[model samples]
Target: MKREIENKSKKKVIIKRQDECLRPSIPQFSVFEIIRATNGKLIAGSDDLSVSGVSTDTRTLSRGNLFIAIRGKNFDGHNFINQAIVKGAQAIIVESDFRFDASQGASRINKDNLSLKDCASVSFIRTDDAIGALCNLAAFHRRRFKIPVVGITGSCGKTTTKEMVADVLSAKFNVLKNKGTFNNSIGVSHTLLGLNKEVDIALVEMGTSNFGEIKRLAEIVAPSIGIITNVGYSHLEFFKTIDSICNEKYDLVKNLKHPFIAILNGDDMRLRKKAKTSKDLNLFTFGLKKTCDFTATNIECARGVLEFSLNKKHRFKINVLGRQNAYNVLAAISCGVIFGLNYKDIKNKLSAFIMPSTRISLKKIRGYHVIDDTYNSNPLSLEYAIQTLSEFDTKGKKVFVMGDMLELGKRSVMLHREIAKKIIKSGIDTLITVGPLSHHAADAIKTKKRSNLKVYSCGCTLEARGILLNLLRDDDLVLVKGSRGMRMEEIIEDL
Candidate 1:
């Protein structure tokens, strides 16, 4: 999986991950087809032209790539048209108001210059919105296939459930899962655009930080089945209440047409209530609760594995440390069962499923057991991490090095401080805070007056790293985590 992150210098930094494939499994398309999908007017080059694939950044543009001039809060792709042409873009999709200049591979665009030889080398599409054109074209191409598409979403466990569902389906079919947390409208479009003949199923993970994103993604995915892991305190900056989060995630189920399957987390009473009114769906629920269609029992974690029994009959052991993963596993298993896979096959497939290193990983470093979950953080996941720490059998004191959890909106500080209650019960000996919000957690813990616990607050990750380096002992167990901006990995990377 490859994702683009912009640094302080305004340059795009591409990080390539090992678990997922970043290379294109894309099919080729003709200029006329793209124009038809995008409702674009051809301005230059022959309508018969073809492009190998699509790209947004000139830094990675290949010779036959169709470049879309997408505008963002910080940068505009239109400003790099000349650079894209020099990098060998076969076509360009620009806004309707974009006027061509001589530097755009040929002389300034005009009716008389439509047949210019220089401009003929590159095709052009003028659309009202470039980003909308990209999604339109992708949805058009997606209409070409009639395979089973599974759309997965939730506040937490979306990626894990998506990966596990993909792994289970891959045992019997060729599956293409969206890479990483690329669950935005743009990322979902890219996944649909990559569909080809060899794929039997498309597993798309949808994420939303605001309203309407899930509905838009569902409009593109047209899923045969949808999985919602759980709606919790995620993206609370935009979605202020749990009820709003519930409604936002339910868009996946509501947008689906008749006769579609809706899989939900049964333990979430909110989802269960939603499922009651959704009588039109072929509903399935999974969790640790007995009433669920698929439920796990005898949950246990030892070393680096999680063991659970489904429906009190079939047993499964997966490579993971978090007992909270039982919910994610049950969701994946429910999907496999709905897809007509036998319990034997599902068991074999799931037993071999190794969650991506990005989710969470337990490692040994210099005689210390380190749990790294620095990908991103939210209240529910943080609570689960603390529970895992509390249950762990450590030879030395258990320590939690947490940074601020972002996107909580007005309740940001309260939520941080709220997590202090979980920390007190976790039996962890030390807490190191790394941001202003996390400072609230430190203050709350101090108010409790826990004599056995020690706390430290720092303004930055570097200061936290220095504190940890001096505070840790030989056999201590440590967990490091934060939201994307806090860079919490600094505490464990070298220590």
Candidate 2:
């Protein structure tokens, strides 16, 4: 009787296994697909083999993953290939000329005297350039999903605009956005590769400092829609002039294939000029002016919340503080409208969208109102932040803790002095400058000899923190901003 019962249970198990085998499964990439995408030589690995996922960092590599060794400034990922293999990376992509050096522990012996290759079923792929190959693979993956990709680029407000656009679009579709401010080549590639059949839209932010960067990113993104927030003096050290910056940023629009939408900031003179000449593209303009295709009017800001109407018909509100953010919202709304999202849905999504941290986030520390904009800064963003700070309703004195706006090259001193002039005009009662370039600002203040203002110049963030700790008052509203290298957020942390 017991044998008869065991036979019945085995039959049931076999029937269930057969049912699962008959079910259709999602098609995953084969080894040949990776070879085709990367144009790489299969050093070791079967053509029919499949990997679970792709990764660059060995620390996070899981079983059946494909690892691409990226060579960065401080670390060479080739050094970690052995660890990745031990952690169960099924395949590895390395430079074509990379060699397995015995001194670097590339070889291991097993109890049966088998080599590393004989002991495990790992595969090796060789590419002429590992990073380029990774990007190619990502582009290939992106091609499989036929979703709308919105590529955003500009010197400032790219991240904020990307977030707002993603939020508004999420109301109608499943959205995949660039995480944080990862807007560089590696970042954009990784973001594009994250797409799958589930995603309905991709919002990518492209950031650049020199020529060809935006073009390369755009080629990989192949966006159906492009957004240029506004050109500014962000990376002048590398670009040298505003014209060069504009040319680099406009690459996104230039790369967009026909039957695409190009959103321009009508208020930005450079973009406005470009829109005039771009007759071949489907152009949409958004700004405060009524002439814009999508216009925001009747603007109001109270208690750090912004309320505005689009063409005097669609009303929207955002909690982020600053009039500059209103332009970003307008850009997002224009994108939503282009995607056929109703104004009501766009407004509802944006109204609940929270601002990204460290981009003009307002907070109360101890008892002081602190405007933290220290993620990164250039002349244009600094001016907007200072202007916003000046307009805030404050019974107490307004103070600014500023650091060097880096990458200005030869124009650093001139720009710093210009900022000092703006600071003086903004009615700031107290100013603390950090970093070497900011010394020019302090000198400009001294040259002006304002009796009502107090100025302090510090060599580094630590010194700035000490001075701010002693100088800050409970009633003061302080604004802190600087380039990423200056780490201006330290003062805010110390306070």
**Index of the highest-lDDT prediction:** 1
Q: What is the lDDT of candidate 1?
A: 0.84
* lDDT per model vs. reference: 0.84, 0.82
Query: Mind giving the per-residue lDDT tens digits that candidate 2 earns over 1-495?
Result: 001111101221110101111211232456788889999888776777788788899888878788899899998888887677777877888997896443333334343244656424766788999999888888887777656788999889999999999999899778899999999888998898778666777899999988899999988998878999998897887899998999899989988854467888988888878767775677777888877877888888765889998788878889988888988999998787776667789888988988898899899998789999999999989999998898888878898999999999999999999888899999999999998899899999999889898999999989988877787787789999999999988888888
Query: What's model 1's lDDT at 249?
Result: 97
Off by over 4 Å in 2: 1-28, 101-120
Q: For residues 364-440, write the lDDT of model 1, one tens digit per residue.
A: 88878888888889999999889888887888989899889999999898999899999998899999989999999
| Clash count per candidate | 0, 0
Candidate 1: misplaced stretches above 4 Å?
Answer: 1-25, 103-116
Error in Å for residue 356 of model 2? 0.6
TM-score of 2: 0.91
